[model samples]
Target: MTQRNSSFPLTRRAALAVLTSALAFGAAPRVALSSSPLDVVATTGMIADAAMRIGGTRANVRALMGPGVDPHSYRQTRSDIVAMTRADLVLWHGLYLEAQMEQFLADLGRKREVVAVADALPEDLLLSHADYAGRHDPHVWMVPTLWAQVLEGIPDLLAAQRPEAAEDFAANWAAHKTELAELDSYGSDVLSRVPEGQRVLLTAHDAFGYFGRAYGFEVIGIQGISTESEAGLNRIGELVDLLVERGIRAVFVESSVSDRNIRALVEGAGARGHEVGIGGELFSDAMGVPGTYEGTYLGMIDHNVTVIAGALGADVDPRGRLGKLATGS
Candidate 1:
């Protein structure tokens, strides 16, 4: 596997300070919420979906990064800053997932009810980042069980802001957890049908480590953990040789990542007489279009499992678990 050297300036103390300040301030005075829905802002769609489900009708949520937006390289625009500053509550996936927005979010934390939801997860459950020392992979949403644990603290976070709706938030959180458990079961059941030898998941970047870990599949990524990392000729050549040698039949492209590196891998393998096909475009750093089933967290994972299993010779429903996924989507 190739590695890239990167550094994040925000430390645990800085993040803790932000959280402390947010708690002290409660809902900042700038946000005038007088009997209106809680104005919530999330950095990624995954967080926004969970917030919406848990907050129910009490919170109006907006995701800063929408469909096909890669959070890794995304920077906050002037409007994003305005939204964050004015929002009653701001939720971001910490652990350096938003590499470019880390400092800005930390700064914003002092003035708003800011929280890093994923940062509270146990260290044992996280996969260490290959490119950044002492940092874990930020793609926990790839696995249902792990993502459930990340949601455990969210109800309380919301409750802290609106004590009157605490019970409602708890109720919603419980229902959402039940749905997540079912999704986890579906993933395990269908993924089990994949032949043991063909259970390798290769994608554009290392966004599926948690998915691979949960399903007992060997995962490969052309680029490092962060899409900002470059894929060099040496790395591409090595992966091509591996594909030809292992008889791996398919490689996947990510919705948010460029397929250039994936295409290069296919071409390289073809030249060596191993015809590799694109398994399917998997939702990696980002999910599908908003308002679509594939845009939701459950749909994202369902689509991935169905596509992976089908492409690797296992029988799977083309319509996916809930039959909500679009045909060929």
Candidate 2:
């Protein structure tokens, strides 16, 4: 695990080929005596989606934190702890996301295959969760390339839990890698349309740093990376001045966090002779509701891209890239 830049995969076609070959040879889902998919648990919806995209019919992935559930403040219930203790393999975002459950994870590791996907990301590249402390950003799934690495780890985790399913896990992962690459390209293409001067991405919090670096935008968040950081009145006032001075007309809100911060900014900007509307809600810490198109990982990213592109005046439709978003993305 040397330091690696979170860039798009170099051999796109080759990766896609791997996915195709592996998936074609994958074994059909087997019925354990319990009659269920593998007992897979992820810390957040985004991570769960990555695992699901790779595991497919071979494994069942569950996110402890569902749509709009804030991971930063999430406290594990007794059942959640019990679930982790018995899981075939437990996956979490790492960094301080599941802070409330950190000890449980540490203890669970002694008896199970528990992995922190965000831990796989290179350190130097990660934005400081704190100045003198944490080495990485827990929001690792925001960058498609880094997320791909997280997904790649799934094969090994699954194989460790169920040795008999190693081949199936690897094959499913290989096949899914290509689709992830395509999704990255789509995000890049849409964001590239916005002019350099107007590339500022103002949001609810500092969740989009990786996304900004990947797609060439300057991200500004009213709140810090950890929502625990206070969004002081002065901080809001200063941001308002900058937004009005920059003539920024649209700012995005997050689906999981309260929009009160952004609402204050809009009202503040108005008082200073500027009018900024809610661009659209972006999925920062979670995905949309279950059973919906946006519920899937790809759909979640697709929804963000669709909304951002349309808001920024990029020439793409709000429906989404390739017209696949019509399915509710």
Q: Pick the candidate with the highest TM-score.
A: 1
Query: lDDT (CA) for every model shown?
Result: 0.90, 0.80
lDDT (Cα, 0-100) at 166 in candidate 2: 78
lDDT of 2 at 232: 90
TM-score between candidate 1 and the true structure: 0.89
lDDT of 2 by residue, 53-122 (tens): 6666767787889899888888888878888887787999888888778887888889988888778767
For model 2, the superposed segments whose C-alpha errors exceed 4 Å read: 1-36, 129-133, 326-329
Q: What is the C-alpha RMSD of each candidate to the true structure, in Å?
A: 13.4, 9.9
Q: Supply candidate 2's per-residue lDDT for 75.
A: 83
lDDT of 1 by residue, 1-329 (tens): 12222223346568778877876888545334544578899999999999999999989999999888999999999999999999989999998999999999999888888999998898898898657678898999988888989878888988887887899999999999999999999999899999998999999999988998999999999998899889999999999999999999999999999999999999999999999999999999787889899999889989989898889989889888988888754
Give the range of the ten consecutive residues with the poorest summed lDDT in model 2: 27-36
- Model 1 — which ten-residue stretch has the worst lDDT? 1-10
Query: Model 2 Cα RMSD, Å?
Result: 9.9
